[model samples]
Target chain A: MNALSTTVGPPAMSRRGPVSTGPNIPSLVGSEPQQRGMGIARSRLVFVVILFCAAFFVMAARTVELSLKKAEPMQVTKQHVTVPPVQFTRADILDRNGEVLATNLGTSSLYAYPARIRDPEEAARKLVSVLPNLSEGHLIQKLSASKGYIRLQQRLSPRQKWAVNALGIPAFEFAPDEERIYPHGRLAVHALGAVNYKNEGISGAERYFERRLSDAASTNQALRLSIDSRVQYALADELESAMRVFQAIGAAGVVMDVNTGEVIAMVSLPDFDPNTTRGVSGNQRFNRVTQGVYELGSVFKTFTLAAALDDGVVDFSDGYDASLPMKVGGYTIRDDHPKGRYLTVPEIYAYSSNIGTARMALDLGTEQQQRYLSDFGLLRAPDIELVEVGAPLFPARWRKTSTVTISYGHGISVSPLALVTGIASMVNGGRLLPATLIRNSEGWRQGKRVIAPDTSRKIRQLMRMVVTKGTGGRADAVGYRVGGKTGTAEKASNGGYDRKALISSFVGVYPMDDPQYVVFALLDEPKGTKATYGFSSGGWVAAPVVKNVILRTAPLLGVAPKTEDEGLYKNVALRIEE
Target chain B: MRKIVTISAAIAAIMSGVMVLLLNIAVQEQASLNRTLAKQIHDDREAIRILSAEWNYLTTPRTLEDRSGQFLALMPLRAKQIVNTPATIPLRPRGQDVDTKGASSVVLSSADKPRKVKKNQRKGTAL
Candidate 1:
């Protein structure tokens, strides 16, 4: 490069007429130096322009390629930008007052990748040190397995998770998970039901509202139930105490709003806690209030008498002969404790006489009896927001014996919920509203009237008489005007009645003149007690429960109490036969 | 002139490179901060869920009832004890005006004793 520069430098100097060969251009003529400088500047400019053109050529070619590629669909950039996956949560269950009943608890589940673990024994030992419940030998064996992934534990509490994290064992990872928790324990287990490990609702309102509960958009909002937690506690406490006192195998009870058919509280005892449903017996999980079908005995007499009056077969002023056991077909119907004389219709109902009820049913015939029972929804499973409801058992081909026995609640079996709802229809101005578990401002459907308003009024009078003068006197909450019927049906077993094992139940309505609420309680196979004088009748075993329930819950339901001396229900009180 | 052009071009190249580096660093920082914020929000939501569940478990009816039984002296209100209206409250007798400043001053005689609750008091009665 130096030799070429020397040759070019002299030629350029000669062309510009330079006299001296000095290295410095300042010592030469001004015109000669200026011409030589111009030539050098032009050459440098051409070199820069060439370099710039090369860069432009490359940029332009790239631009052309990009533009041409736009026309080809296969050239589309399918960049798979991954995002963190969001998990769906189950909605919370709340009482009417916005108190939490059931909720989805977030937890961290631990899993192990055996193939990624450095030392199975060391990892298992460290893990067991933090989690004492985990078996060291089992964990070691599990961690040493060749499986790519293995679940080590599930539903770890936050503290437990922290302890496990502190261990810092390799190959152990925590996966976020959830568990369904029933906060109330066994208080409303039968109502809230339970969820499986997969977070799917298995029974009760949980199963009924599964779709709405798991919806991602609505999961945060709590699903409000009509149940008032305080009233539910009261009902459950009274029922459980009664069950204990009576030595019953199990018990069921319900408190329903007569006007709306909203079940304020429903309890089926011998219930298992939803939190630990493992190894729970079938009997413990049975929701007797809505699932078990029993012939509710004299509770059905309310309907028989109402049907008679509604069909114009009898009047409140009419009298029926209870002088002897009335024979119907091959069966003879007799009162539990007969009056031994003719009694008025109100008297017959107050005493809950099977003879009077069967006679009335004979007068109405089987078709009319079937129609009334069907209208009361006694012939079908109750349409409620629960999956455990039982379809009623009744004779498909109605006959004379069927009518007679059904009148006294022996020839048919229905759930306790069905009986309570039927009584609600008879007393709530005759409107048979569909019972519901959801709270509604407008209550349930008004429904068609099963009986005339006048008949309902007369039936209410008869019901109040039962509390005032007869078997249900034990259920008379002082100022609440507690009114209902005592049903002591011998449970049918082995194709025959088990007389010793009775289902003692009472369907009590408060403030009979107003009829705002209906409370029904039933005890299965309650043994005779010393306090009960060795009698396990409905009045002895179940009526006191109703009395206490009304006393405790009426105030919670906002039913005003009248002084007994106020003569509020005096007009409806029945005169007892001496 | 060539020297002036060459110096200006070098300065421009260095400036562009520094600007690109600074912008790239800023964008990367923003993205990292966004990821951190998203994780924080997710954790906060999970914490809230856990706390609410714990609150529910602590306030269950059974637990509350147990607490009440141990600590509270209040009993469930009875139907007869509930007064629907102010008029239903028996007025204080005239002779008991010694300390009428407070409604609690009145003392009841044996005759004013509460009537027994027949429904709850009766035991061993024939059914």
Candidate 2:
């Protein structure tokens, strides 16, 4: 037993020794403890790795969710962002003084997507309630149309828009529209012209400057004019009053600055308000100042005499054979009040002798007459801001008969503006400037020379003489030194002069010694009144109107009342024979 | 050595937390600038619309004429009232000349001395 125990103990001890040293034996022998430690460390590392992976997965998922959300919104925004096409709109029309004569304001016109309207009748009823002017039947028809969009009403006011918006109908939409407004009422209607519903200029200065006002590439700036509102009002008032007093069909007047060639005031009676263009007659829309060509009676005598004086055919003291009635061609040239005696140049103008004027024209000849008339802006249309100017109706063939009749203002028919421009040049030191409505930085362009300064002075004296001593006596405003000529021509009927129908007109210049302004007033087919003593001459009808106009406007224009000794009147006034 | 390693690890963790906080603040500032720019653009568009409307209102003829009438004390002009620049524009009288003219002729009385003429009036006359 002792031998067997010793053998087992040695073997066990040897085995134990080998087990302690061997790699797999110790791992096996202590496997439980090692496994426990390895399990704990492995579990801890695994836990840390799992936690890091979970955090990374969470961050990646959050990033993907945020990017998806951002992508959806960006795509929606891209779809919603609409770029509108570029287009031009009409420009505004303005008065000479930078006042808005006409302008376009943005308006919202209500339209409907017909397919989207749930109940046509209910929608129409609501629309008609907001817009009383629109008929219910019209609105219903518009809403029931098969078209994609139907216009229910145009030019809706802001209040109306708000009322329609408050209904909150999904199908309703507002399309932008442009509307024109004229704020001056009826003032300067003839000059401002009228526009279509689309705001296109149809006539007058509006039409003349249409491109300037409508073209965006050019400018959207306002147009400044030479007109003074105060001056325009005063002239229109006097002209309207005269028209009523004379019982005339129509009357026209113009006020122009002689130096600048600016039209300060222009009036045509029976003018229609531009704001409401409907129901206006063609005659009411006519700008008689620039459009009507009339044989403006003896007012032509001033131009005739000025031509003679400028051509050196007649001097201040020159005399003509006025004793006998001059017969040219088959026509008899006789004055209304026949002097039947030879008259000096001044007498010819003061008495307004037709025979003397005819002889003066004959001496000046056709070439000189044409040259002078062309220089006076009578051959062509006057340069004005309005497009309604009329060309003078003179004989194409300037024969002896035409010349003789045109001398006393019979054969030629010209617009009131033309006559005014011519007279302006005659008195404005021979400088023929184009008449302008715009207030230019540099005033009227100095045009071609027409007459000499001396001739202009002489003409000024003749005009003054007529006002003080002859037919224009009633037109003489005190202290203002008004100078003018009276013209009363028989209107033509069936190629012959009418005894009953007459065109009476007056052309006047103030402070004649150094003439500054030219005034022209005309009465179309004026009838004789009891106050006029059954006479409808320019002196009886048009002179008084001009006289009052000058008297009232001079002080307002800052022109001091002239004393008798003032040099302004020294050379221009003629000594009247008692 | 063990203690030193532990202290270094603690400082690194604190710095990482601060870095995350700074990144969050940077993102917030960028978003705020974008909003402010959008608001400014909206305001500019509104200003343009109001200015255009006001410009149209001020230039209407009826309003301008009414204002001019009140300010200038003017009347309608006749052709006869206008002239070429006079060879010589008459000068207004000084002290003695004003006295020679009756008080009625003078526009202003002693109570209302002729003050300085307005700049608009001067420009109008010059034109």
Listed models, DockQ each: 0.27, 0.08
Q: Would you list the clashing residue pairs of candidate 1?
A: none
Interface DockQ of candidate 2: 0.08
lDDT of each: 0.84, 0.77
lDDT for predicted candidate 2 compared with the true structure: 0.77
Candidate 1: tens digits of C-alpha lDDT, residues A458-563: 7887888888788988998988878899999998889889989999999999888788899999999999889889999999989999999888778878888875
Best model per DockQ: 1
Candidate 2 per-residue C-alpha lDDT over B2-78 given as tens digits, one digit per residue, 9 for 90 to 100: 56766786887789889998988986786676666666665665454445546645644446657889899886555
**Candidate 2 lDDT over residue span A170-276, tens digit each:** 89999988776665567777877888777788887778888887888753566666776656766787888888887889999998888888888889988988877
- What range of 10 consecutive residues in model 1 chain A has the weakest lDDT sum? A76-85
Candidate 1: Cα lDDT at A144: 89
Alpha carbon deviation, residue A469, candidate 2 (Å)? 1.7
- Candidate 1's TM-score reads 0.78
Docking category of candidate 1: acceptable
